[model samples]
Target: MSQIVVLDTNVLLHDPQAIFAYPKDEIVIPAIVLEEIDSKKRLADELGRNARSVSRLLDKIKEEGKLHSGIKLPNGSIIRVELNHRNFTQVQDLFGEITNDHRIIAVAMNYHVEQQALPEQERKQVVLVSKDVLMRIKADVLGLPAKDYISDPHLQADDRYNGYFTLHVHPSIIDEFYTYRYLMVHNLGLRHQLNPHEFVILKDELGTTKSALLKVNANATKLEPLFLSNDPVWGITARNAQQRMALELLMNDEIPLVTLTGKAGTGKTLLALAAGLLKVEDEHKYKKLLIARPVVPMGKDIGYLPGEKEEKLRPWMQPIYDNLEYLFDTKKSGDIDKILMGLGSIHVEALTYIRGRSIPGQFIIIDEAQNLTSHEIKTIVSRVGEGSKIVLVGDPEQIDHPYLDSMSNGLTYVVERFKQEGISGHIALEKGERSKLAQLAADLL
Candidate 1:
């Protein structure tokens, strides 16, 4: 049976291509949704961009056929703009208001009644698809089937890749790896498949303290010893195995993309900065170190602050400056600024200004990346030019974006999508190293 999927305004704003997601089903865009999209198209943000894209898509679709009547989509499904849903008595009685959400729900309810009035064999299934939780609830209360429009598959917090695994093997294998510095993949007796650049802690089957740190090659065909650094980068050193694994990937120029995820105080930002500094300043692998992050407000926006662009960005980029001060060992209040001026190799900017420019020969670090959408991440990654590497560091659990969550954030999306690529690596830090109080708050609070 053909299905009628009514899309909500949030779905379209979240992803303009949502209309094409349901290829096998008929798409219904209520007239109210278009109005909502129109209201948001003038804003200056990612939502506005999506709204404009959706408008363009609708305009192009209009040329194919009249949107009021049924129009055949590329996938052989029908699409129609619903403009005749005037009856809202049922929704008004249930919700006590003819709000925009209720109006959209009323359209779905109208479709449901129409389908129900038809013969059972010829009736179509009507489902209201929305990204809003309360909207879906309201639809369900009105005897309409509603669901979340999930485009990407979600990974549970515990099921996410932690970059390193503990493998139980014989003591002899550990000895062989220590001596040869390389181990065969078959000899690990592994049950689970490992991705490229995945770290493994090989332990003896007897549960002794004997263990070896190894990393999977790009092809996942061989295991090699991790590149353990004796010297510290700036003043920071890897305090744990996971940190060590993250450092190896961060410093390796062969890996073009690296994602680091962890709770607050996991040393994600510190490690990334340390590695980026080492590669950019010490080794001169890249021309400069470019750091950018999404400017997601904590409680409210900083627009009302008393300054220009740099002043407005100071509050959002303070954390990055804090790490820089610590790494540069700024003894006085303004010592860090002097050091940065002398180096002239590091640039810190907002993610908003990074579009449409190709970045080449630079080490880019995108902190607080969980606040970005998947589309924003795609845009940032595509800007990488030759001889450049980008590091995305964020705590998925600590997202500040209202429309994003741990599983739906860009950090997790890139982690899951790039795990199989040889040029990419990821590590989820487990332990927190910020401070005792902060770590306790992250764990117990």
Candidate 2:
């Protein structure tokens, strides 16, 4: 039987290419969904950009045939603009509000009823695709099949990659790794080869309490010891194996891109900030240290807040400011602010203003990256000019974006996409070193 996939407005806004995503099945866009897209196309944000993109895609399809009637796409799928299924009587009792969500669900219900009216042999599967959780629940309550649009396939928890693993090696191999300072990759003895720049914790197979931490080279050729410096970055030392590996990647100029993932109090932001300060102030490796994070938890527009750009962003960027204050060890009120005002090397920017600019000779740090989409991260990373490094740090499990999660967020997406690349390095911090209470909360809570 053929299938009809009804898409919600948020799905298209999240990924404009969701139309062509169902290449093997028929696609439907409720008339109310078009209204939602039209409402968002005028805004000056990523959502607006996606709304315009989806409009262009639908316009292109219009040239092939009438969209009101089913148009055949080259991918053997029929795309249709659903105009007649606007009735909400079927779900008025279940969902009292006749909002856009209700209208969208009503369209799905109409299609499902139509499909059920057909003979059993000729019935088609009708499913509603949405990013909204409540909408999916409502669809289920209304006896309709609803699914989330999985844009990146390898985002499930079971399929997610941690970029590091424990390998049981003979005690002799551990001694050889320390004596020769390198070991063969073949010693891993895995069913599949590990990714380049992957980290490993080599433990004794005999459980003799012998262990060593090593990193795989870019070519996946051999295991080399981490080239970490003895001195700390900005008087902050690594507390664990993962933090040490993270510092190794952060302080290295050879790798231009690095991703660090950890729960709260894992020192992701503190370490990235320390490395940026050292590179910008002590070592003079870059011209400036640029720090940015998406203001997603708050409303999108900064105009709603009072004062100039810096003052307006102060409330939202307090976390970054707090980290800076700690690094500078400033006790007096506004001491860090005075320092930031005098210093031209360190800059903190809202994620909004970083667009459409070439950043060069700077150590850029993007915090709370898990709240951003894959496209948003791409736009930020592509802005890196020559002689620049970009570090994305976030706890994917604690996302603020409505449509994003631990797996599908840009932080996880970047880690998965660039794990094998030579220019990139990643570390997933498992243990939280914030404090006794913080670590306990992270684990037990």
Which candidate number has the best TM-score? 2
Tell me the tens digit of each residue's lDDT in model 2 across 1-445: 5699999999999899889888779899998899999999998878899999999999999998899999998888999999897778889877787988999899899999999999999998999999898999999998999999888754687776677889887899899999999998886577877888888899999988999998888888899998886578898999888889899899989899999988899999999999999999999999999999998854656778889988889988999999999999999989998998898889999898898789999999999999999999998898899999999999988988877777778888898889889999998888888798999999889
Which regions in candidate 2 have their CA more than 4 angstroms from the true location?
299-301
What are the lDDT figures for the candidates, one per model?
A: 0.89, 0.89
Which regions of candidate 1 are displaced past 4 Å?
113-124, 154-159, 186-192, 299-302
- In model 2, pairs of residues that clash are none
What TM-score would every model get versus the actual structure? 0.92, 0.96
Please give the lDDT score for candidate 1: 0.89
RMSD of 2: 1.7
Candidate 1 displacement at residue 181 in angstroms = 2.2
